[model samples]
Target: MATIYDVARLADVSAKTVSRVLNGDGPVGARTREAVQDAMAKLGYVPSNAARTMRSNRSGLVGLITGAITGAQESARPFGLPDLLIVQGIQRVMASRDMTLMIADTGGRADRVPHLVRTFLEHRAEGLIYVAEYHQQIRLPQVPDATPLVLVNCFDDAQSPAVLPDDRQGQHALVRRLVAAGHRRIAYLTLRADMEATPLRTAGYQDALAEAGLPFDPAIVRIGYQSDEEGEMQLLWDAIDDLLRLPEPPTVLCCGNDAMAMRVYGILRSRGVRVPDDMSVAGYDNHRIIAETLYPPLTTVELPYAAMGMKAADRLMSLIAGQGREEPAPTLVTGPVLWRDSVVERRAATLQSISL
Candidate 1:
């Protein structure tokens, strides 16, 4: 393998000049920098990261921990894959700074985190990011005071710096748009009642209805599923039947995610209900696989998984640079609602409640 000395000789410069160009530490003439790069490319020369780290007295390594599996799972959730997407986002940002990213998948085991953390610290990771499969709460073992640690899609009572999706805001925006489009009697088919996003999204739905002077009809709200089990599809179908049976059926059905929305599409088609012509639909988490596949593509909100990952890395880097806030409040990233062919403008009279 070609060394820095060989590159310097080919470029007609000193090894220190090659180092300067590689590390971007000190300025070299633009011509000299170009020549060095060309020479290195010609020789397929790769810089030694270990040598660079040792010289700088910093690891230049960031550690990421997640509960997501590397392969297909028997119990994977529908819609977005926050863990994998977040890691990809983090890696993208770190690569721009010439930092190495080390990832550890715990295989859905929380008990493995502490061991992973210790191993990362042993390798002198400059920072750490802990990501969860979804937005939830968690507790972790004590980390060294000096190490910069950030949480993504999860939080603890300790109020450590965290980055999360603004689910409530995203839902609120979606609902508000629907309301503005003259949709009054909107049905909400929710996800698992126990998940943190469930209540937050419900609140957003209620907020939009209240703002639009629409009555909050409990009958139109249905808990579609408690988990991503195949058995839950039956419950969703039952909820749809219940909603359609109402005296004044909803003009639109807002689903928890695109996967659920796709299921709704199949059920509605089976009943001869043309989407946007007879009933409209909207969903969250713009999982392209589900959202874009429906006859008329599903309108939904982006989950902002990658955005949260990038933001978490920014915060981690801030802490590493000794610029952390006095009180590190949770940072929220909101995704814009994606408009598609699934929904349509409705007449005001079509949204009125029917007499019992």
Candidate 2:
């Protein structure tokens, strides 16, 4: 393994000069830089990350800690696609900047956050990004006053920057579409009310109902855990049964995610109910499998995972570059809706029945 010393010997420059060139800490003559580059290429010299951190106290590495709840019995893993997309975006930006990433999964292990932050600090990470599997309020570990930090799909104190989807706007848009298709008795199946995204989406549901002059029926709103598939299925089944027994059941069911929607689809199918024709369904996060492969494709909101990741990385980089100003503010991104085959115009009889 070629080291910085090897490159220095080949380039006939002091190790400090090589370090300066690598860290961009000081200017090196163009010819000198070219010689160093040439030597690096010839020797297959890979700079020692440890030495670089020692010189500048900057790791040139970013830390991404994810707090995803994989054990939940939900329709799907909540953070899978968004986390992947965010990482892709972050990598896109980091690659251009010659930075590397160190990712850690917390698995909802909130207590380990302080230790994780310390570990990244020991590694001399220039910045940190904390990603939550779902949008929820989080209490972050106490970090160094100088270290730049950002949050993805979650928020903390006003001092840190965060980037997440605009759930309220996305849900509102989805509900409006259902109303346009003449769906009045709309039901919403959501995660626990305590979850951050749930309230935002629930607010959107109410907003659409108000706009359409439809009465808000609490009975049609159901909430459950997001931890596992069996629990999710059971909760959804119970919600569906309750909704079906209503004097006039909803013609539209809007789910918090593709996972839940898929479960609902299975329950409905098993009960001999046809999709769209019998009940229109929509969901958020637009999980690829559910959107593309389901018997009746799902209409869903596409989370701007990549964009959020890119923005979060950019913001963190800006902070690291000393370009950040004032305390960090929460950032929200909006994803476009993907229309699919899961929804249809409410039949005249269905509409009449709900009205009666």
Number of the top-ranking candidate, with TM-score as the measure: 1
Tens-digit lDDT string for candidate 1 (1-356): 99999999999999999999999999999999999999999999998877877788799898999865553264455655446788888888888888888999887778989999999998889989999888899999899988888999999888889998898999899999998888878999998888989999999999988988888999999988645457778988899999999999999999988878888898899999999899999999888877888879889999988888888888888888889766456899999899999998764455553422
- Residue pairs clashing in model 1 are none
Top lDDT prediction, candidate number? 1
Q: How much is the lDDT of residue 40 in candidate 1? A: 99
- Candidate 2 Cα misplacement greater than 4 A, ranges: 1-45, 48-59, 67-82, 157-159, 224-226, 346-356
lDDT per model, in order? Answer: 0.87, 0.82
Off by over 4 Å in 1: 1-55, 69-77, 347-356
| Tens-digit lDDT track of model 2 for 45-65 | 877767666766777799988
